[model samples]
Target chain A: MLMILDYIKEKAEFINQALAETMDQLEGVPPVLKESMKYSLLAGGKRIRPVLVLATVEALNGDEEKALPFACAIEMIHTYSLIHDDLPSMDNDDYRRGQLTNHKKFGESTAILAGDALLTEAFGLMAAGAKNAHLPLDVALTIIEEGARCAGSRGMIAGQIYDLQSENKKISLAQLEQIHRLKTGDLIAFSVRTGAHIAGASQRTLQALTEFAYGLGLAFQIQDDILDVIGDQEKLGKPVGSDQEKNKATYPALLGLDEAKRKLSVCIEEAKGKIREHDEIRPARLLEIADYLLSRDW
Target chain B: MLMILDYIKEKAEFINQALAETMDQLEGVPPVLKESMKYSLLAGGKRIRPVLVLATVEALNGDEEKALPFACAIEMIHTYSLIHDDLPSMDNDDYRRGQLTNHKKFGESTAILAGDALLTEAFGLMAAGAKNAHLPLDVALTIIEEGARCAGSRGMIAGQIYDLQSENKKISLAQLEQIHRLKTGDLIAFSVRTGAHIAGASQRTLQALTEFAYGLGLAFQIQDDILDVIGDQEKLGKPVGSDQEKNKATYPALLGLDEAKRKLSVCIEEAKGKIREHDEIRPARLLEIADYLLSRDW
Candidate 1:
């Protein structure tokens, strides 16, 4: 456990440094626009997605340096989605990760453009990185296409619209899982798969990693739902039962608390099982991440 | 003139068909999301950007089929920008091309997501197209990077922020031009450059085409300003003098109506001259397109 903690910390620091350098290199962007983009992108977080990318690459014995741009690109996409989701027209949240939301700090218009710039520049960075890293053109193109499909209309955005529609309505557990699967699951899967594909993993290896990814994604969401129901207000930075208060569909809402926790355990175990089956790949950190999500309180 | 008009109309229909087929192929997107995306994309216009891509490829005697994906990609980017620009937080316009703006037709959140989807999927389509077109990897990477850079923070988004900041405030002529140059000019320049680059035109040809693109972009904006000041209202699907009413800085506002018209003429002539220098490329349609903009009212 301690070793995994140290690993995450080290990789997260590396990711943060790369992200900061990327922002510094954006010389052509307007100063204020760059500032807003950096605010969300550089805002300290668990850096889970990027860490997964690096860890997966390392697990596959690939060059971590070659994966850095992709790691950064995924993080940028994540940050942009958060920024847009926080807008008045969307989730309308005032704070995120203990800081003023983007639209709260920057005006809505700037916030929107910042998100736009981040999303657009993410592709630019990835393409440039692919060329610099000397990745094969076909591999680069496939990875790019995967990123777009996962993050675009058919994936995360689809989840968003569905989530919006499902609000204030009673939805079944299957429907709830479907939303999380597309909304957050696809990107997380893409992050891990990107690392595997870049590392030249076999098709069988890729398949195992993908299953592990989806399991981890679902477990993460279920944990969030569980925490929202039974979490410390001060520690969680929001009131407990807020999901219930909003009539939002959640795992615990549909299943009893004990059942939800049991489901989370099953997800974690299943995820770890998939990784363990590929023991030759050195997936210690990936397994640890699944366990971390299972036990995390906030 | 008649020939150029016919060329545009014919190419626009082809572009429109391709766009419709692309939308039909998006089976994974939620129906509502797809509907909103199609609303803006298929709303119909002169299809200027996509047409330029095809025309430039044709002028260089390259495979028009190979350039179709890029042409569609540029149009998608253009449509996405318009969708977001019409959002309440941005331009707050209620009508575009004689139809209700995206947010007006669909709710604000869906509209925002639709714009995001279009932007994201444009890259996906381009990547897939690059592979199908069998474009050289280096060339594909360069073009994708160019699209991202031009449409991103340092380019169109920068222009949008600057334009927002300068609203209702006095801005210098150079500043206003700078805003439009980034906002609209960069993408226009990208369109022509993509076609030229894909057709494997020489550095000299690319440089000339780039200059022509920028000139035409500025001329188009200047003509828009001229129309806003002195042209018919209903013909434009919006009222004239709207820019004046909002105190928005336009070419005509900054340089006076007659001077702005003169500037437009200069831009058109210079743009045509650049193409004439490369008569070996058979740039008649490109030259005529510049002339078309010079005389367009709405």
Candidate 2:
């Protein structure tokens, strides 16, 4: 257990360094725009998605250096989504990570451009990823296509659209599940699937990992909704009751808080069970992530 | 000459149809989001960039069918930029091509996401471009990388930042050129060069085409500034003198209208001279475009 925890810590540090280096490349951009991108990217958050990519690749016996570019790419896409989602026209939050949101600090126009810049750069990084992987061009292109699809309209953006439209309206549990699947689950699934795909994991292993991630992603979001409704603001690093204040429909809103927590526990159990099917030596980090996601108070 | 013009028109029509068909593939997206993307993409501009790409590829004896995906991808990137630029916080224009801007019709958040969707989808198209081209993965990845770089921060977005910062400020001709080179020239050069690169045009030809596009792009922007200063709103289909209203520094702002026109004339001449160096027919369509751009009353 200590070894697993130490492994995660070390992987987190490596991914964080890669992300910082990728962002530093943007310094060659116009100073104002570069500053705007750097401000949000470096604002400090748990580097979970990148760590997942790195860990998934390693679990599949893939080269870590080859996966590094993609690890950075997924995080950039995730960061850009956050910047846009927090805009005044969207969730309208004033702070993220206890720091001013991009729009608040840089103004709306710059913030919008910063997000645009980051999103475009993410593609650049992905294209560069192929070269890093030293895989055949076809393989790299496949990975990129899958990742971009997971991040785009058919995926995360669709999730966000449904989320926004569902606000202040009555929605069913199925609808909420659909939203969470796309909004949160798809990218998480993509992280694992892409890592496996790039590392040339076998079909069975890739399928297993994807199923595991889907449940894990759902459980993670459910826990997040539960935390938002009942967790302390200082610990969460943002205000509580925000979803309710905005009339945003969440798992806790559709299902009672107790029911939502129970559902999350089920999801975590299922995710763990799927991970258990893998070789005993592998999926250790994924198992830990599933457990931590459900157990964390924040 | 008339036959060549007819040929170009036929190719443009074919490319336009392909673009529409590629976009129509975005069908399964939520109705509202799909509408947002199609609203701008199908809004019917001249389709000049994509046409240039197809023409350049065909002129180099490359498969036009193979290049169609890239043609569509460039247009998507172009449309996404227009959508974002027209936002209330950016250029803040209410009209484009005689229609309400995306933000004006769809609201800011939708417009923002719509732009993001288009940008993300563009990579998907480019990744798919490799399949269409049946080329080596390395070549296809290079096309995507170069295209993204041209459109992203070190390219178009950076150009926009400088343009926004220079508003109402005294700036020199060199500074204005730098802004236009990035904002307008980079993408145009990409359109021409990417096509040539994909077609396996000789390095000499690609270099000539790039130089030609650099001048043509600058000339295009200078003409646009000139039109804004004196063109009719009714004919242009958008308000004139917007630059003056926004205090945007332009060619006319740096040089008198007469000198700006002279500079346009020189650029047109230089662009034509470069194209004339090519062995295949002198790109008469491009020359016509240069003339139309510099001489348009609107």
Candidate 3:
């Protein structure tokens, strides 16, 4: 467990340094906007998505350098979505990770532009990655298209709109699943699958990785909902009960707490099952992540 | 002139049909979201940017089919920016093209998501174009990077942020020009240059095309300001003098109406010169469009 944790920590550090360097290289973004983007991007997090990308590459014995741009690109996309979701016009989140959110710290207009810039920069990085990594044109094109599709209207944006419109309304579990699948699952799956792509993994390997990502992504969200209801504020670094306060639906809200926990366990189990299928060839990192995610006893 | 006009009309018709078909083919986008996206994208405009894309391709004798995706993508980007700019958090305009703005038609959240979708979809289209056209990896990568850079923070979004920050405030002529160049000029120039790129034009041709686009983009904005001051509202299709009402800076405000007009002519002349430099091999459409844009007598 500790070894896997160390691996993630190292990967996270690499991602952070790369992200900072990328921001420094932005030639034309205004300084203020750049600052806002960098601030949010550099804010400490688990860096799980990026780790998944690199670990998947490791599983396939692919060039880690070739996947670095993709790892960083995923983080940029994640940060941009966080910034936009925190806007007053969107989720109205005032604080994130115990610090003032992007809009709170940098004003609304700059925050908006910062998010826009990050989103743009991510795609630029993805395309640039194709050239920098010497990946085949079709593969690079596929990655770009998948990344955009997962994050765009029919994907994350759609989830957000559905989430917003479902406010104060009774949303069914199926509808909630649809929203989460779009909002969180799609991007997480893209991250896992994209790494597999960069590594030139087989279709079978990619499918298994995607299945693992889907299960893990939902379980992660479910854990989030559970934590929100019963979490140490000092450890969590953010307030709890905000979802209920906002009249937003969540796993625990729609299903009973016990049922939600049961679902989380099921998802984790399924994810592990998928990872175990590739046990001979897959790296231990993916399995470690899946197992560690559900174990509450730290 | 008549020939070029016919060319533009034909191109616009093609773009319109392609855009309509594309919207209909979106797989997972919700019906309401699709409606919102189509409503804004299909709304009639001059199709100037898309036309420039194809015209430049034509000028270079490139495959029109290869250029179609890019042309559609640029228009999508243009539409997305307009939708976001009209949001209540930004410019707060109620009408666009003599119709209710996206937000006014759909709810605010839907409109915002629609814009996001369009923006994301546009990137997807660019990548897809690379595969469809079988362009070389390097060229495809370059197009994607340039598109993202021009539309992202350093370009259009930067202009938007500066414009918002400068609201109701005194700004210098150079500052206003900076804003316009970033917001309007960059994407316009990108549109023209990208088409030249698709044609595999020489560096000299690309540079000349870029110079023409830069000059023409700025001049187009200047003419817009002039129209706001004195042009007929019915022909313009939306409320005039809104920039002045918003206390936003404009060419007429900074350069004075007379000086602005003189500068507009200088820009037009400069743009024509760039086009004429390639007269031996370049298509006449580029020069004709440059001349036709500012000429009131259709």
Which one wins on DockQ?
A: 1
Worst 10 residues of 1 chain B by lDDT: B233-242
Off by over 4 Å in 3: A296-298, B279-281, B296-298
TM-score of each: 0.98, 0.96, 0.97
Stronger candidate by DockQ (2 vs 3): 3
Query: In candidate 1, what are the lDDT values of residues B225-288, reduced to their tens digit?
Result: 8998888876776677778877899988888888998898998998888888675578888988
Docking verdict class for candidate 3: medium
| Decoy 3 TM-score against native | 0.97
| B-chain TM-scores per prediction | 0.97, 0.94, 0.96
Q: Give the candidate order by descending TM-score.
A: 1, 3, 2
Instruction: Candidate 1: count the clashes.
Output: 0
- By summed lDDT, the worst window of 10 consecutive residues in model 3 chain A runs over A289-298
Q: Candidate 3, residues A186-278: lDDT per residue as tens digits?
A: 989999989999999888888888988989888888888888887776666678888889988999999989999999999898887886868
Tens-digit lDDT track for model 2 on A1-29?
Answer: 45655766787778778877887776448
lDDT of 2 by residue, B1-298 (tens): 4555465567667777887787777644777888998899888776778878877786677777788888888889999999998998888899987789998999988999999999999889888888656777667877888887899999999988888888779888899999999998999999998788788877789889899889989998998899999898877778998998988888887798999989999989999899875795347666776676677664
The all-Cα superposition gives candidate 3 an RMSD in Å to the true structure of 1.8
Q: Which stretches of candidate 1 lie over 4 Å from their true place?
A: A233-240
Per-candidate fnat, comma-separated? 0.83, 0.69, 0.80
Candidate 2, B93: how far from true, in Å?
A: 0.5
Candidate 1's DockQ: 0.87
